[model samples]
Target: MSMDVTFLGTGSAYPSPCRGASAVVFRTEGDCWLFDCGEGTQTQFMKSPLKAGRITKIFITHLHGDHMFGLPGFLCTVSLQCGSNPTKQCVDIYGPVGLRDFVQRSLDISHSQLVFQYRVHELLPSHDQCPEGEFKDFLSLRRENSVDPEDQGRTIYENLEEGSYELVADEQFTVKAFKLFHRVPSFGFVIEERGRPGKLNMEKIKELGIQPGPICGKLKLGATVILDNGQKVSPCDVLGDPIPGRKVCILGDCSGIVAVGGAKLCYDADILIHEATLDDSQMDKAIERGHSTPKMAAEFSNLCRAKKLILTHFSQRYKPQELVTDGDEDITVLKTQAQSCVLFGQDVTLAEDFMTINIPIKKNN
Candidate 1:
C-alpha cells in the first residue's frame, strides 16, 4: 500500500524556466490527489509520466495565484481528455472559501464546456463563514453542475476536536486537514494510511512443526489453533509486531508555526512537506510575505518530530546549487548548540520540479 508523491511544481510566487509554482501529486492504488495547481501546473505535468486526466482530486491551499492560478485551465484540459463518459472520470476539488466563485467565474467567462463533472468541497474553519453560493443553484445549472448529490460542490465545515479533522477516509487511508496561519485563510493536509496486522512468523510455525495448510490461514485470522498432538498455538505467539501506518503531512505556505493544535497535524509524520521560501538570513522578509525560512520549517519539523522534512516553495533568489548541490541533502534540521546558537543537519530534501518520492509501506511480511 505504498504511495508516491510527485512534485509537479516547487517554486514560490511565480513560475520560472527551471521551476514552476506549488503543485504536488499524491498517488495511491486507485486515487490521484493533486495539491495546489499553481501557474503552469499542466505544463509541468506534461513533463512527468502522470496524465493530467487521471487527477481525481485537487486541493488548493489558498486563493494565491501561485497556488491555484492554473485550476481553470488544468480542469478544462482534463475535461477534454476525460471524454463524454461522465461516470468514467470526474474531478473533485477541495479548498477554502471563494474558490467556488473563482473557478465558477473563470470557467464561465471563458465559456468552457466540459464532458465530465467536477466537484469542489470548500473547507470552512470555525471562524470563517461559507457564503450562500451556488449550492442552491445546482439544480438550475443543468449539466453545468453535478447531478449526483454526492459529487456536487459543497462546503465542509471544520470539525476538529484537537487540531485534527478528517477530509476523507476509507478502509485503506484517511486524509486530514488542519488550519495553517498565513496572510490569508490556509490549511494543511495529512495522509495517514491505516495500520495492518502483523505478519505471521513462518519460522516459528515450522519450529513447532506446523505444516503449511488451512491451519496457517486460521492463525492469520487470530484464531487459537490446536495441533494434532493437543498443542495450542495463539496467533500472538508467532506473529511479529503490528505495523503502524505511515503519515505524510503536506502544508501550505505559513508565516510561522501554528501554536494551537499544530503538532496534532504533523506529530510523528514520516514526511513533512513544508515550504522553505527563504533562508534564515531573510527571516524578516519571509515573515513579511507570510512565508517560511528553512530554519523556521526546521523548527516545525523538529517540534513535530517528523522523520523526514521535504522543503519546497523555494525563493527565486537562490540558484539550484545554493539551496542544495547535486547529491547533497537539502532539507536541513537545526538543533541548538546553546541558547541561541544552532547547527544544521542536511539529512532531508529540497524538492524540485518532477521529483518523485515513493513512500514504501513496511509490511509485516
Candidate 2:
C-alpha cells in the first residue's frame, strides 16, 4: 500500500495570495486524513484533485487563526454537500482545548449545522506528559508552567472517553502523536503501518491438497486449525515473518520541546515534515516568535535521524520564483543554503502547496 501526502496550504501565519494556511491531506486507499483547516481551505479543496467527501478525520494543530479559521467554512460545506447520507456518518475531529466550543458556537450562531454528524475530541487540561523511561530525563528539565494547558501532547489515538489510552482505531497503519513547543499546545503526528505477514504461496497450497477456500483464509488470518481429516495447519508454516511498515511524521510549529520528549518524538521517521517558517538569517526572530528557522529544522532532522526531511510552512516573503530566480548567490536567498545542505545529506525536499509526495516502499522478497 502507498501513502500520498498532498499539501493544501504551505504558507505561515500570514495569509498570502499565493498560499492559504497550514493544511495537508494524508491518503491511503479508502482513507483520507486532513491536517489543519486554515482559511480558504474549502476553496482550496475545490481546486485540488481530491474529493471533499473522502476526508474522514481532521486534526487541528493549534488555535491560531491561520490554522483553524477555515474550519467553520469547511463544516458548512460538508453540511451543504453531505445532506442526509452524511448525517449518519460521523467525522472524527481532534483538536486542542476550546476547539469544540468554538466550532459549536460558530455553527450555533450561523445556524449551519452539518448534515453529517461530528464527534469532536478536545484535548483539554493538556496531556503533554512524556512517556516513561528516557523521556523522563528530558521532561525533568522543563519548567512546570511552560507546558500548554490545552496541548494534548502526543495523542496516539482518539478514544470515546477523554482519558482513555487504549487503541481507538486499529487499521493496517497506526497513527501516533507527540507534543511540540509553540505558543500553544501543538502536536506532531506519525503514521506507521503495521507489519504485514508474507503472502500465501498458491502453488504450495495446491500441493498440500488444500482447496482454495476458507482454509486459505485461516492461514492469512494467522490461525492454526485442524482439517476434517485431522490435519494440522499453522500460519508460520505457510507464511514468512511479518515486514515492518513505513513511518512518516507531520509536525506543526515548534522550536523543539524538552518536555514532550523533544527530538526523540521524530526519531527514525522515514519522512519528517518540520515547519520552516524563517530563514537562517532570522534565527533570532524565529526564536522570539516561537518558530523554527530552516537551519533549526535541518538540525532537528539530523538529530532525530530521520531518513528524509521535508521543510514547509514558509513565510509569505519567499516567492516560488525566488526559490530559483535569485539562485543561491542572490542577496535575498529565500531558502537558506544550510537547509538545502542538510536536505542534500539526507535526500530531503522542500515541499510546495498542492504537491503530492509518494514515499517509496521497500519491495518484499
Q: Among these predicted structures, which one has the highest TM-score?
A: 1
Error of 2 at 277 (Å): 0.4
Q: What is the lDDT of residue 244 in candidate 1?
A: 83
So what's the TM-score on candidate 2?
Answer: 0.80
lDDT of 1 by residue, 76-156 (tens): 888777666566466778887678777877898999987777877777643321122312222233244445646667767
Whole-model lDDT values for every prediction: 0.77, 0.71
Candidate 1 residue runs with Cα over 4 Å from true position: 84-87, 126-149, 203-234, 322-346, 363-365
Every model: Cα RMSD to truth: 5.9, 7.4
In candidate 2, which residue pairs clash? 154-177, 154-178
Q: Highest lDDT, which number?
A: 1
Per-residue alpha-carbon lDDT of candidate 2 for residues 216-329, written as tens digits (9 for 90 to 100):
888988999787779897887777656667777888787665342546646777888888787878788887776887778777778778888788888777776545354322
